[model samples]
Target chain A: MVTTVNLTALRRDIASLSERNALEAQAPRSAFGFGDRSIDKVLGKGLQRGALHEVFAAQMHDAGAATGFVIALALRSSSDQSPIVWLEEDFAAQEHGFPYAPGLNHLGLDPQRLVIVRCSSPQDVLKAASDSLGIRGTGAVIIAPWSNPKCLDLTATRKLLLTAQQTGVPAFLLRLGAIPIDNSAVTRWMIRSNASRSSGANAPGHPVFDATLIRNRQGMTGHWILQWESDNHVFRQIEPVSGAVVSTPAHRPPQTRKSATG
Target chain B: MRLTALDERAAKAGLFKTMALTDARAQFENLDIAFASPRKDAALLEKLADWCDRYTPLVALDGADGLMLDITGCVHLFGDEHQLRRDIHQRLSQHGVVVRSAITGNAAAAHAFARHSAGDVIEDSALTQKLRRLRLVSLEIEDVHLAGLKRAGLRTIGDVEVLPRAALAARFGAGLVERLDALFGYAHHPISPRCVVPACMVERRMAEPLIVMDSVERVLHALGDELFRQLQQRVEGAREVEASFFRVDGEVRRIGIQAGRPLTDTKTLFRLLKERLSTLAEPLDAGYGFDIIRLAAVRAERTQTIQKSLDSTVQETEEIGGLIDRLSIRLGTGRVLRPHPVDTHIPERAVSLEPAVHTAANPPVEWAPVQHPGEPPERPVRLFQPPEQIETTAGIPDGAPAQFVWRRVRHTIVLAEGPERIAPEWWREHAGALTRDYYRLEDNRGHRFWVFREGLYERGQTTPRWYLHGLFA
Candidate 1:
């Protein structure tokens, strides 16, 4: 009689586990695409709407490009009528600069639709970001921390992720001057600035970025060179030019190449 | 040095104010003495006035040592005028303060009665008779005017009042006559209150002091309901609301909440207040508990009632506004801000961040276009307020830099865009400012920078300086 009861309990546990997996698979998740077919295909149609995505600058100088990429993602994921909340650390503002309204407008975001919260510390940024993400009507939240702060642990990121999932508002965590660390994010990206296609007479064209998917929960990681079309508010694949000559490094000597590569 | 003030013990020991320290010490070998600070005395008086807010909203500072409470319509709340005076004196005395108080038809008479005769509630019928018995010093005239009045055989207010016509004005220069009229209750003398009298007010007096937050919140909600009911009668809404907590021991704590729009909902007001109280730097110390809680609408505005609609857009706007209010209260109002575009050519001044609670009510302004249809952005994504100076080597004086060093990194220019000349606003205060020539440059590693050279080399200025103003995405 004891053996029979144990078997029945074991069967019930397996059945419940499978049922939970099935329910998770059946849940509907709406995603917004990057407009580039290649990138979207790898992302399984598009990026998930209500998930925490981490973006890191390859180097400190690439902060501007990383910021632009996040803003473009925010604009794409949410409607124009809904406001985007930006939580920035005071150190980051002092190191990089303040987000200029005209520059944000130049990136196709209405300056009026942006609400900014300037915090003195990373902990405050996290606190305000969590509060903003819990609200239902917020379009998206952008949290920018200057460097790797001790307060930003796995637990904090997980809390932010759970709040985002519950409220259906996407959150982007932008890290400048920091390397990729342990986080509970759906996707992680490393961004570097790419040379834009110069217009006539060596004039720089639209903004371009070399975005590397370092980690993806549901798909394989990939890299791509994407150009931002501000007028259309979408990211497009860079076109290949025929017979283009590669320019040599003017500042670094050839002997340093091996060490740099290593 | 001379003594500026004295306590009861020192006064009983024959040490009056303005007496020399040596003389006082000679009179008593070991008399306790302390140097007086008029500033501290004034501060203590101000605090006492704040505590007196429990009696009436029109409490004002009467000198460096006294408080004047105008209880015109508030006398009925505490039984009667005599009962109110007794309540004030008893409460203050329990706090270990030497108390003297009076109630009269006007502030000047009340001031005189309190200083001369400790406790008196004089009626209007006896105002003239009371004024006649007061001495000339009660009028608070200058020493020179007092001596002149004494030499003229004017020892009391009645002595001066009987002779006041055109002759008194000529001798006292119209000041003493004004003081005499004010004492007789003929001239108006209003006391300037410490706080603005709220448009609508409601209060709750608990028999038992409240120490728990739950009870405090309950009392706030009840007071909010009563305040809203009064506001609804006139079709008005509050823009700012203040809650004053009078502790059992003479301590007052005031918390104020400001809304983006005129607020009429009691639930919203309570929620905002709860957020503010929870996030305060120093939590409310309900030492001994609060006996009196008062809520007042300090600022109100006319609000038109709108019909409720089924559209989700209206509900969404309201939800967003509520979120803004909560965030503003939690993180101070100045921390949460909305970007406002200012019409100017300078990049930093073009956008000003105003507090979100204020800008939410005003219509959005038009932002100047910063990008062209087919070209890159004319402005950078992030701009430094005061541009950082950089070292650069331009191929020519009028051309863009070929190489530059910024923040200890050397960047070789791979591509460059021109000389978008933005001249200073010569029509304004920057008349002597030099014209700047800006360039958008891309380095070999592909980082873009917006750098400008201040002053033209051909304009007969000294060596031109280059600055990295912003970074492009």
Candidate 2:
């Protein structure tokens, strides 16, 4: 109360901090990309490497779509020497078919490079995922749970994120037919199958996905229609179609509400 | 009641072996003695033999009360023959056991000399002279033979030695001659060790029982150094090493470490063993602490001499193999794995995770060839075992489904292809088994599904149940 305070200087400090934050968010810290504008453009930066991403589907039939979405992301960052390891936490193999090497080979992905770890419970799967992702050169580790397990709490999610970030390896949590609550993942995606476009009377077109960003740290929640190119191992943008929208309290873009008062 | 044996203190108080326990008590009025059980004595002898194994692996039971140690080539390890004998005597004395030890070249001479005269290493040339002066009891011959020698006025080994060999044999039997030959270092005397003798072995005897892990580790390190030295001499390395810890309370715990390749360096050997010890599910139990620890190379192989250079590719492979070996020790051998391929159409049976060490030695695996070299895939990337049963409705009886309800979700198929028929192998499949008709169905939501119709609808069958087997990219 006794000293004169510069309100203009204080305002300048707040503006400069926000500017630095916006610039810092531009580099994804070594994350790999999905090669799709709908995701990359909204993120402002690329997909973050050495971070955790959570993905879940709404129904059992959509479980396959959820898994494919994660596999595409994992394979994008993996190589023949250091491939992705998938930890099957529950009996998801019975629910959504095991990974077939022949089908994978046909898609130009080497199944031999993939290592599958079958664990008994969700806790064991998370433990295995944490251990595997902690390996320095291991590209990515995937945890696929058959259902929404009550055992996956916030602390467990944070542990996975810490290990992945410490070792500089990405970790993907694939939830089958289960909506996940909030945790430490830098990004959370709810992926579901979108109706495919037909090229001819009998020929099927490219695989398409209705991907919704549920949680984003660097950007805002958005929805996009993405198509998978099997030959190129990339995802292409598709024109937004009707009825691809999922509603749940209409997540407001958090950054848009900021009033600069400039 | 009768006493079978007496200790020195009781004997000093006018007690003796085979005397009536009541009579001995009556004589001293306070003779502290108990009925000697033979079983307890045998157990003690067995433990003593196991304890003596730390000296040389060549320890065997001489009789009810004696242990024979073949100290040949092992004497230098404890400084010299006399020093080893002194050390053994001192250790036993400290254990409250009255012990007499003789370090000799021959087992029989050592056995005979340990009881009479001075328990010392007699020169090889003076062995016969030393035997001549010993009493007949020293020869370790049967009691009947000793009795016969006494009756024949040959009360000592010299008396029997002077007699003609054939005459001596004719009188006391050939057993006397074999005993003389063994005692005089003229015949072979082999000892059957209680434990298997490894290719190379090193051991450490603790003066004080080691109850802590650090002490065990220290002993293991010391023993591993000696073993590593021996392995170096043969220009070979140990492929599998076994470490045995003998507890003071008579329990033996063994830990074994297996390497992906032959390992000789002491640092690597000790490091691997330490990792294995720490990772054991049931940790090493040292009840009452261990008195002796032994390190032995159970198996060995010729180590390939690599031309050491900055060639990192070869080094990387070796480093990875080492990492796998370390991990297998902790996570179990089955947990650490490498993908191996099989030449089969059944997907589950086509690929499996094998122990990483097995694949580490073999050449890189080649995945199955693609059907259409470079085309966008029409099949799903992931396939599951026991294809999941899905409720799908088809237009024609044998045709693919235009719409299907799976997991409570109905999808209308917009485009579909494939009727790739896969019949179960005739020899492997039973008669009435269905030949599968697989179809790639693309629902309106671009959800690609691999649905297979089992058996033909015309073959006296109900509605052919469709199973969803895979999901393509």
Q: In DockQ terms, which candidate is top?
A: 1
RMSD of each: 2.9, 10.0
Candidate 2 — which residues are off by over 4 angstroms? Answer: A1-28, A145-151, A197-205, A240-262, B1-202, B221-242, B257-281, B294-327, B373-379, B403-412, B427-434, B457-465
DockQ of 2: 0.28
State the lDDT of candidate 1 residue by residue for A145-214, as single tens digits: 8799998999999999999888789999988888888889999999888778887689877888878888
- Against the hidden reference, what TM-scores do the models get? 0.94, 0.65
Please state the error at residue A24 of candidate 1 in Å: 4.2
lDDT of each: 0.86, 0.74
Q: Candidate 1 at residue B202, lDDT? A: 93
Q: Pick by lDDT: which candidate is best?
A: 1
Question: How much is B391 displaced in model 1, in angstroms?
Answer: 0.4
